[model samples]
Target chain A: MNISHAAKASGLPVKTVRYYADIGLVAPAGRTEAGYRSYDAASVRRLAFIRRAREFGFSIEESRELIGLYQNDARSSADVKKLAAKRLEQIEQKQRELQVLHDELKHLVRACRGDNRPDCPIIDYLG
Target chain B: MNISHAAKASGLPVKTVRYYADIGLVAPAGRTEAGYRSYDAASVRRLAFIRRAREFGFSIEESRELIGLYQNDARSSADVKKLAAKRLEQIEQKQRELQVLHDELKHLVRACRGDNRPDCPIIDYLG
Candidate 1:
């Protein structure tokens, strides 16, 4: 299939697919006589894997590491487990930060009377 | 006070303070004869405000808009309210995305045996 077909199958934009190729994330299986990229089922699977990894919020570098491990038959499951644990820790920290912001914003919003007068606790807190 | 003093007071790095100034997020109150930036209490407050807004996940442009609303006496509290509501919505969306990723990662980790054998469910899922 062509790049567009690969993109559609992988649920990534054609631009992103090209960028992935540029960054060595997914190299096309071959090229057509017209210099366009060609892909097979294996290439499509690789693209899908990359897309799934990205959706899970893995950084490009982390995705690369995962892909490398995926390709390496000698790779240990412990290594992947370690990476997933680290990602979970990062996500938990972000969740805590977001919860704090959510609580603070909810309080500010609740305190705001939303009256016609200019006196606003939201502005007061922000200012 | 000097930029370093302002950074120390505002809990921001000197490089970040300079970046904020370059992006028009905060302008120095004045400059000394030696070409060093000078600040007053007001500038420090502005930096603090910017830092706090950033901590709340507001983009630089959103922070600028908040600062603009803050500076404009004629600005209605409704305008600020709207901006805050939008930010809350954005944060909520991010929280949802992170939650999904977290759940998926948790499931994958739980399924992994982490054995010495090369046959791994984690690799199976990734591959």
Candidate 2:
């Protein structure tokens, strides 16, 4: 299949599929006679796997590790679990950071008079 | 002062200051005879405010709006409070999304056997 077809099959954007091909994460299985990129069934399958991993919030580098484990017949399940745990921790860190921002902004929002007056606690704090 | 000095005073990276200047969000106060960017004290203050807003999770476009209100002496406090409320909502939405991802990944991690074996429920689910 062409990049667009592969992207459709994988439920990924065409640009993302092209980026994967360019980055060598999922190179086209072959080139057509006219030099068009073409992917085999296995390449399409790999793209689908990468799509699922990304939807699970894996970064490209982490997805590469998962892809390695996926392809390695003797790979340890422990490695996969570790990777997933790391992603969970990263999500937790982001949530904590966002929570802090949420609370801080909420406080500023509350403190503001929010009327026709030029004076604003939110602007005062930002300044 | 030159862009670097302005950036230092504003606690923003030199590149970021340059970007703001280029985008016309915070244009340089003037240019030196040597054609280097120069910023006045008032411009520096605006840059500092923008930096603080960004740290508070405001996007560049949102920062521009805040800066506009800051420069407008007749600006209503209600506008500033509305912006802050919007930022708070954005942060909350991100927290919810991250929490969902965290829970899903945690579930997958728990289900995995995580042993020397090649079998992985995570991989199976992805597949």
Best by TM-score: 1
* Candidate 2 Cα deviation (angstroms), residue A11: 1.4
Clashing pairs in 2: none
Candidate 1 accuracy as lDDT:
0.86
C-alpha RMSD between model 2 and the true structure:
2.2
- Per-residue CA lDDT of model 2 for A10-111, tens digit only, reads 888999988998898988899999998898889999999999999888989999999999999999999989998888888888888888888888888888
Chain B TM, per prediction: 0.94, 0.93
DockQ, candidate no. 2: 0.75
Each model's total of backbone clashes: 0, 0
Number of backbone clashes in candidate 2: 0
Report the error of model 2 at residue B15, Å. Answer: 2.6
lDDT of 2 at A69: 90
Best by DockQ: 2
Question: What are the per-residue Cα lDDT tens digits for candidate 2 across B1-127?
Answer: 9888999999999999999988999999899899999999999999999999999989999999999999899999999988888888888888888888788788888999999998999998787
lDDT of each: 0.86, 0.90
What is the Å distance of residue B117 in model 1 from its true position? 1.9
